[model samples]
Target chain A: MRKQHWIEVGVGAFMLFGIVALIFLALRVSGLTLDRNEPSFTLTASFSNIGGLKPRSKVTLAGVVVGRVTDIQLDTKWYEAKVTMSLEQKLEGLLSTDTSASILTAGLLGENYIGLTVGAETDVLEDGDEIRDTQSALVLEDLINKFLINSTKD
Target chain B: MIGLDSLARLGRAGLALMAALGRSGVLFFQAVWGWPSGQGVKLWMRQVHFIGVLSLIIIVVSGLFIGMVLGLQGYSILVGFGAEQALGQMVALSLVRELAPVVAALLFAGRAGSAVTAEIGLMKATEQLSSMEMIGVDPMRRIIAPRLYAGFVAMPLLTAIFAAVGILGGMLVGVDWLGVDEGSYWGTMQATVDFRADVINGMIKSVIFGLVVTWIAVFQGYDLVPTSEGISRATTKTVVYSSLAVLGLDFILTALMFGRI
Candidate 1:
């Protein structure tokens, strides 16, 4: 009976240790912060071309991550990509209505993310408001083609 | 005449293999027909202690060493490309997505699976299982079901532990010894390794491996011929078949989950 009791304790401890390990894997290794419930608001941007931008890609302000791209879809009527972003609530009333959004690539051959540049207008954009100014992803192929054509003509 | 005799032997072997597969499938269903009741829970715990707790040391030790080796090798290779920062991503992804579950399952097969087979096979060889049958107690219910349940629960946890420990080991080597930037090591890993795709898929693999290993172990034990040589053969078969099944199923599962088709 005593041995059985000890075995039960060991089993219980082993299971508890396993759960701890799973939580570590989820939070630390996999980087699942589970912070989606934090206060944030949605905003949208339209781009002619998003390139390799994906949902969950970081939205950065001056190289600091301020939000994440929550959804990306094509606006069939406008014939452009509609991107929805969730920003920190602390940024509310800070970003002006005329702020510009551009898809930017990280490093060379790295992932593409959204970069935000502040605007000077006093009126700030609110949740679900779409930014008007946008720059499409710079396709390297297009740049190479133009460079090759200009050099050949010279 | 010789060709005919060889053909007849082949047919018999094929029939035996089919019969064994069918019996094992039925045995799995019978063993897992329902959830454990009040008294069955204790037996389940005991099995967990026997199988899971006993196997922890091997899993952790091997995980640490394997992770350190990955870190060392990854750094040497990535340094040439000036991509040492990606070491964390490489280690975590490989461990979480593939190595942790598959290696842990193989070890579990060798250690716990073989042990379960030998114990049950010995019981059969000694007529203990038959004695329980004569006494109106179902050995399958009391003995086999609890072990199978414990195995199903233990495997995923063990795999998780293995991944967690392996990551730590990699960090120890990559960050502490190798002088890779700690922030980039962890940050890039976090950015790249998706929780749903990598971690959850690995967990799914572990669960499937658990089912295969335990099912093979219990079936091999129960179906063995009641003799010393039979028990030895059953134990060997448990390890061999469980390893093969885990590896083959891993490939199929990986293709289904990550093939993006």
Candidate 2:
């Protein structure tokens, strides 16, 4: 019985260690970084609907994550979700005065993401500037319900 | 007159079946909820020792091989499309969403479920459960509850083990074996695969599967006759029912989550 107990303990310890190690390795390999190299700037995007949008969501420009959503606040003035994004230093120069931010899907049924369309204007938008012309995501369920409702009328 | 009597008997039978099902459902929930009490904790730990710790090596080894195979297969397919970077996302999503939970549940049912059925069957044969009842003890709250709770807790932990090991296996093939850049593999996964809902869905499925497997095993065991043949039949039923329930529950969960018909 003593021998059996020892064996059990050994096995349990090994499994616990192995699982923890694997999770640590996965997190490390996934490039989950906290250190910032360049001066970070914040910009706000207001959307009528930020469906399932949460802080720490990636802010993508041309499908690449340039920053992350830092804060999401309800704008009482406009009754919209004001999403504040922290842009990485390297991508700061691309945020022009005419740049447009839109809430879009990564793929069909995928999570909602912020997509930045680089503007042609030469002047870069300063920090804290709002990207006012933002498009909200077209929720698929709502669209389907609308289509079904509309089609029944005819 | 005879036809009317027969109709009444059929209606009574239907009502009985409905009552049995309703009682089982309520009992299952109560067992699950009452599992965190002091005695329940000890039972849960024992189950963790048996199910999670005992099955770790097998789960990890299988998970690693599955991950490696997925990486090799995904790499080949993506290379054909000239999109090798997507391999990480493919492996991560498949492992987390499907393979890990199903495989872990199947293994748990076979290893732990069978043992539970046999143990309870032996107790029933020896009149141990009857003795408990005579002594004013509730077997459902005491014996069955702990086993069910243990299973519920163990399944998710085991699933996590499977997912973690599978990812490592993919990383080994993508980085060390195939000479692909480690950064890109991890980068693609972080960018595409890791979602909050994926983890939640996996855990929820695992917990439900665990409860079903344990409940079926205990129910069969408690209903077993005293003969050796009855024990054998109980064991067989336990495994068969557990596996079917796991698969059936997985289908329901997947449909509900993805909202596909």
Candidate 3:
């Protein structure tokens, strides 16, 4: 009976370890924030076409991710996709007032994300300020259509 | 007359299913009704050791192999798109979201689940269950309930083991075998997976499947006709029905939890 109790306890410990590992893997796989004290800064951008851009898409400066697309909606009056990005605190003061945002593909065939290009400006852009110089997603179909028309004219 | 006859048969089938459901519900309540005595607790612990501890090797081996396969496949495809760094994200998401819980349940149904059905079915065939009842003991509370609870408790842990080991296996194939940077593999996975949406949902799936597989195994055994042939038939049904139930429930749960997004 004492042995049985010990065995059960051992099994219980094993199970607890497995559960903890499971939670760790889940957290690691899914990019949920672990720290609450980490501050986030949200900025907005407008584009003619977001293409396949969706919420939670990575926002990158150069090749490294600085934040994520937190929300996306239609700006009914302007008739464009309005994107809101939440950047990590470390990326603060990195964006200038003249900085431009572009929707860029990760590769020739990969996920679409917003790319930040630094501009020559001493003044930094504050939160809630719009990124004025923006490039929309390049639609493949439209580009093909333009190429066909140009070839026909030639 | 033909239509009426078919309707009557359909009604009969539905009624029988309902009665079976009601019986199982009663059995479940009875099993959890009283605080377990020391002997009963001991019996349960032995069963858990068999159902969970004994099956660990198979779960680990299968998990590792499956993860390796995912790593290989994901690398081949991602390399084409020059996004091989996302291999970790792909492997982790696929395993946590679908593979681990569903595969573990299938293996459980095939291995431990089948054994349980056969054991209970044999005990019934030998009149042990009846003899116990004759001595004023409830076979359900005494015999079936402990096994049922053990299965219920063991399944989630088994699934967790499967997922965890599978992720490591992916690392083995992706990082060591394929020359993927270990930092990027782990980093990308951490950046992509969500605790509540992907991981917790997978656990919930395993929990539901645990109840389903055990319920089918115990019910099939309990309702077995008293013969050698009957025991074999019940065992077969236990495996088949449990597998089907796991797959079917997985589809429904996935649709509910992830379909819209």
TM-score of each predicted structure versus truth: 0.95, 0.70, 0.85
lDDT of 1 by residue, B40-156 (tens): 899999999999999999999999999999999999999998999999999999999999999999999999999999999999999999999999988888889999999999999
Each prediction's RMSD to truth: 1.7, 8.2, 3.4
Taking all chains together, the TM-score of candidate 3 against the true structure is 0.85
Extract clashing residue pairs from model 3: A28-B190, A29-B193, A30-B193, A30-B194, A31-B192, A31-B193
Candidate 2 residue spans exceeding 4 A from truth: A1-65, A68-154, B1-23, B26-30, B33-40, B135-137
The sequence of per-residue lDDT tens digits that candidate 3 reaches over residues A1-154 is 7878787886787678677767667555565666845788989999999999989899998888888899999999999999999988766777888899999986676679999998999998888878999999988899999999999998
Pick by DockQ: 1 or 2, better one: 1
- How accurate locally, in lDDT, is each candidate? 0.94, 0.78, 0.87
Docking class of 3: acceptable
- The DockQ of predicted model 2 stands at 0.17
True contacts kept of 2: 0.13
TM-score ranking, high to low:
1, 3, 2
User: Fnat for model 1?
Assistant: 0.89
Please list the residue runs of candidate 1 whose C-alpha ends up more than 4 Å from where it truly belongs after superposition.
Answer: B1-7
Candidate 2 lDDT tens digits, A1-154: 6755665575468557645743543464334445645578899988999987788788888888788899999999989899999998766666788889988876575677799998888988778888867889788899999999999999
Tell me what TM-score chain A of model 2 achieves.
0.75
In model 1, how large is the Cα lDDT of residue B118? 96
**Candidate 2 structure quality by residue, lDDT tens digits, B177-226:** 88767777877787655444565577678778877888887777776787
